[model samples]
Target: MTLNDLSPILLDAAAPMINPRDVDKRLPDMIAGGLDAVLATAGAIEDFRTTMEDVAKWLEIERSGARKIKIARSVADIREAKASGKIAIVLHFQGSDAIEDELDFINVFHACGLRVMQLTYNARNRVGDGCFEITDGGLSKFGRKVIRRMEALSMAVDLAHAGPRTALEATEVASRPMIISHANARALMETPRNVSDDLIRAVAASGGVVGVCAAPFFLTKDGPATLDMLIDHAVYIADLVGPQHVGLGFDFAEENEEDYVYFGYDERYIPMPPWTFPSRIASHAEAGNLESSLRTRGFGEAEIRGVLGENFLRVFEEIWGC
Candidate 1:
C-alpha cells in the first residue's frame, strides 16, 4: 500500500454502540486508534425520550473541558473534527423503536443532530422485522412514511440488524441509498445477522455502501477472527459490488457489557446475538492499526484508502452534504 492509503482521516462508520455516559471515557481510544470521526450509536430499542437523553449527554461532552470530540452534522464538520485532532461524532440510532408513533420527531431529531436511524433492531418493531425475527416482513406503511421523512430530513438509513427480506424491501423504497452500518456477508457465515449477497448488491445499486462488520464469530466460522478476516469481508463486498460501495463499520463492542433483557444470555439458545463478548478482533484502542494491517497484507493504497474510511466519507458527503 502507498503512503496515501494510510491517510489519518480514518472514519469509523460504526463505532461500538455505547451509552451516553461512556463518551468521555471512549474519546481517547478513538484518537489513539487513529480514528478522526465515527458514527456513535446513541441508543437502540428505545423511545424518542431516551434517545434524546442520550443526545443530551453527547451535547454535554461537546461543552465539557478539553473538548476532545465534536458533533458532526455535516461532512464539513466531520472533516473539521479530524483537522482539529478531535473525533467527530455523528449521533446514530440502531433501531426505530425510538421513533415510536411520532412521525414528526424524525425532523425534531434531525434538528437535534441525529443523522442515522435503522428501522428495527433484532425483532419485529413498528418499522419492520429484524434479522432475528421469525417473519421476514419488510417495511410497514409507517416504515415507508418514516423513510420518506428521513429522506426529506437527510438522515442516513441503517439496516445492519435488519432481516434479509426487510433490508432488501427497505432499499426498494429508499430514494437515497440505505446503509447496513455494520454487518458481515451471510455467504461467509450463515447467520441471520449477516446480510445476503442480494441485499448488499441492491443497497449498493441504490448508491448506499455496506460497512463490513469487525465483530468476531461473524467474520469466520472456523475460528475467532483477526483483522485479516475482517478485511476478507470488506474485500468480498468490494469485489461483489465495487470498492466505492464498501467501507469500515466495525461494530466492535469488546465485552463492555451485555443486556440479556432482550436477546437472552445463552449462545445455544440464540447463536446470532453477541452473547459472546470480546470479539477476537482488535478493540477501539488498537483501531488505528486496522489500515496498517491492510497495508501489511499488500493491498493497493487506493483500495486501502477506500476501505479504511474514504468510501463511507463519500457516502456521508452525498447524503449529509459537504
Candidate 2:
C-alpha cells in the first residue's frame, strides 16, 4: 500500500452517532474526516438484556459487511482498520448500570469486545457516584470490585462523567490506569463536568490518559467554541502532566443525539433536561481541525501524535498487552 493509503491511526476517544445501524451511514463522513477508529458508546445505563441487544447490533454490522465498519478489540485491530481504510469501532460504556449487580458480567462484556467502562454516568450507581450526584457519596465497595475486575480482565475504566469524590478515589484505588475518557479542564471553564487539575495530574500519575472534550460549555464562555478553545484545554493538561498524558475525546455527535439513553435520573424527575447538556463541538469533520490547532500552539509532531491517538494507543497496549 502507498504511504497515503496507510495513514496514522487517528482515534477519537469519545465519538457519537455511534449506533451499529447508524454507523453505516456515517462511515463516509468518518473517512472524509480522517478518523481511523473511534471508541463508540455501546451501552450506558441500560439493562443487561438491553446491553446485549446493543452489542448484538454491532456484531450484526460486522457480519453484514466486510469493509464499512468493524469491531476492534486490540491495538492491532485498530491498526488493521486504519490500513484498510475502515473506521475501527471500540465498544465502550459511559456507565456501568447495564451490568446491574452482575460483577461477573464484566467478563461477559469484555469477551464481547467492550474495552472501556465508566464507573458512573451522571448519578450514583452500583459502581460509584456520577458528577451530577448531589450527595457525591463516591465509589462504593462494589465499585472497587468492579475496578479490580476490569483491571484483571484488561477492560479499561473511565471516569469522565464521575463525581469529584469518585474520580479522586478511582485514581488512587485503581490497580491499572483509568481514563477520564472525555472531559476538559475545569481550570479553563468552571463546570461540574469539567475536570480539575488535581484530578488531571492524578490520572497522569496513575499511568492514565486525560482526553479533552470539545463540548461548548467545557471550552469557555468568552466567545464561540472554536478549535483554539479546545487546544487551550489540551495545553492546560499537557502543561500539568506533560503531553504524553493528554489526548482528544472530542465527544462529537454527528448523527442522532437521541441514540444515547440514561438510566440514572429521569428528565421529568430531575429539574432539567440532560439533552440540553452542552455539545459544542460542531461536527465530526471538525476532527481534521485539531492538527493545525496543536501546531499553532507549538506542539511538535510527536506530541501532536500523542494527543491525537498514540498516547491513548500506549495506554491500551499496556492494558490489553497485545
Candidate 3:
C-alpha cells in the first residue's frame, strides 16, 4: 500500500549547518522507505518574511528537481505524482504565527502552494492557545476568521498542537473536516502534547482524521520504544474512530540534545540520548515496519490502506476539492 505521512519533517530541524533547502536530500531514502507522498513541514513559528523565504526555497527545490519531487497543490497533483513515480511534497506548516494578524496572507501562501496549516505551535498565538499554554483560551476571534477563510480557500486546518479547548472550539466552528495532523493519545501517554479522548472524538465526529505520531518520547516513557508501541496508538485511534479516520504522521527529524533544549521542551518529555527511534522503524526508510506491525496486530487490508494514506487523501479531497 502507498504511504502518506501528514507531518514529516523533511529538513533536519536540528542541523541548520547543512543546506536547509536541499529538500530532495532524503528523496531516495523515503522512496526506499515506502513513502509515496508527504505533507512536508515548510514553516513553523516563523514570521511572514521568513516563512515566505522558506516557501520560495521549497519552490526552487521543486523546480530544480521536478523529476524527483512534485509540489502538490491538489489531490490531482498527488495522484499524478504517484503515477509518474515522483514523490509528492505538500507544503505544510506546524503553526499559524507566520500569517500573524494579517488574514490576507493566507491567500498569498495558498497561491504559493501551502496546502496544510496548523493554528498554533505549542503555546499561545494570535490564532489560539497551543497545548503548552497553562490557561487554554480556545480559538480567538481572529482564529475563527482564519478557519473560515481557510475552509473557503480549500486549505486544510490542522489542530496538532492546539490546547483542548482550542481544538474543541475549532471543531465546533469548522463546518468542513479538520485534522489533528500529528498527535498521539494522551490516555496512553499522559502528555499534554497528546490528544485527549474528548478531542479525538470531537475531531472524528466532524469527519476529521487523526494521524498517530512516531516520536519515541510520545510513544513511551520507559526504555527504548518499539514499533508495537507506535501501532498501539494507531490501534487505539482506529478502535475509537474506525480505520477511515486513522493515519500516520511521523514527525521525524534529525536532532541533538541542544535542539530540544533550544526549543524549550520539558526535560522529562525529551528522550535522553542517543536519540534512537524504534529499531524496526528507526528512520523514514524503515517506515514499512509500521505496516508489518499493523498486520501482525490484526488490521485488515482496507483498514491498513486507510491508516497508510487513504484517510488523509479523502480529507484532502473533501477540503481541497480537487
Tell me the number of clashing residue pairs for each predicted model.
Answer: 1, 1, 0
Q: For model 1, how does the per-residue alpha-carbon lDDT over 16-59 read when each residue is reduced to its tens digit?
A: 55456676677677766778778888878877887788888877
Give candidate 2 misplaced runs (Cα > 4 Å).
1-6, 254-281
In candidate 3, the residue pairs with backbone N, CA or C atoms under 3 Å apart (3 or more residues apart, or in different chains) clash, namely none
lDDT by residue (176-238, candidate 3, tens digit) is: 999888888998998888999988999899898998887788888888888888889999998
Error of 2 at 25 (Å): 2.2
Ranking by lDDT: 2, 3, 1
Comparing 2 and 3 on TM-score, the stronger one: 3
lDDT of each: 0.77, 0.81, 0.80
Query: What are the models' TM-scores?
Result: 0.90, 0.91, 0.91
> What's the residue-level lDDT of 197 in candidate 2?
84
Q: Candidate 2, residues 82-126: lDDT per residue as tens digits? A: 776678899998889888998999889898899998898887888
> What lDDT does model 1 reach?
0.77
